[model samples]
Target: MASRAGLPVATAHRLTGELVSWGALQRSGQDYLIGHRIWQLGLLAPAHQGFAELAAPYMQDVLFVTQNVVNLFILDNDQVLLLERMSGTRVGAPIPARR
Candidate 1:
């Protein structure tokens, strides 16, 4: 991580420790993760929520009728984004998000 960030190893270690202390990040074995604090802050802005809200009622109807997982995707340039998903009561297969 230090190499990727172009910071000295010791400096990166100290900074990462501080971030963890402040709940901005969490340590998961050898990996660092964005913590609950960051996720909570992000919920405040809620980018792309307008379209999602408009589609939500229809999505709910579809879920009610099909009783299956429904996902919404939008093509942005070369990438396709999963903007919304509605799954029935059961937990289906996991679909992880990627950048």
Candidate 2:
């Protein structure tokens, strides 16, 4: 959205703060993105995680075959947590397992 609007960094920061305070966005580290409240409200409609868990094996097989990055994400309060990720290179990136 900032990229589309061509907003300067200060303006973006201010706008993001407003949104976050209003429960529309979440500030995590230096990244301003979506918040957990939205995810919880959406999940209440169909129990999204349970269905995703059941399908994870099939997804993992495809990801393994392709040797590509696979990520499963979850929201925790103001933070977006990575539940799972499959990567071949262990040293180049700063991942939770490596850390």
Candidate 3:
């Protein structure tokens, strides 16, 4: 991982330890995964908070009318991320967004 990231092994190890202590990473068996704290912080971003507030009413309307599922998405580089998801039905599979 360090070599792939172009960092020395020792430096990567130290930085990884720091991130773990800072609640940014969590040990998962032999690997590290994003921690809940990082997710929480991401939600605190102004863009995300504003978009969520702005989309709330529309999301509710979709649920009220369709009685299916409503998902909010935003473009990130070349991919779309599911910013918010409100499900009115439980049976359908997830569909990827494009743009």
lDDT of 3 by residue, 36-68 (tens): 789888887899878978998999997876666
- Which candidate ranks first by lDDT, i.e. highest? 3
Total clashes, candidate 2? 0
Candidate 2 similarity to native, TM-score: 0.35
All candidates in order of TM-score, best leading: 3, 1, 2
Q: Model 1, residue 68: what's the lDDT? A: 71
Candidate 1 stretches greater than 4 Å from native:
68-99
Model 1 per-residue lDDT tens digits across residues 1-99: 899999999999999999899999999998999887876675565665876888899999878766678887778799776678887764564444557
True-structure lDDT of candidate 3: 0.84
**What C-alpha lDDT, on a 0 to 100 scale, does residue 19 get in candidate 1?**
89
Please name the candidate that would achieve the greatest TM-score relative to the true structure: 3
Clash pairs detected, candidate 2:
none
Q: Model 2, range 1-99, lDDT digits (tens) per residue?
A: 577779987897788788799887887887776787765577665546675677589768856555557677778699775555666434354444433
Ranked by TM-score, the better of candidates 2 and 3 is 3
TM-score for each predicted model, relative to the true structure: 0.63, 0.35, 0.64
User: What clash pairs does model 1 have?
Assistant: none
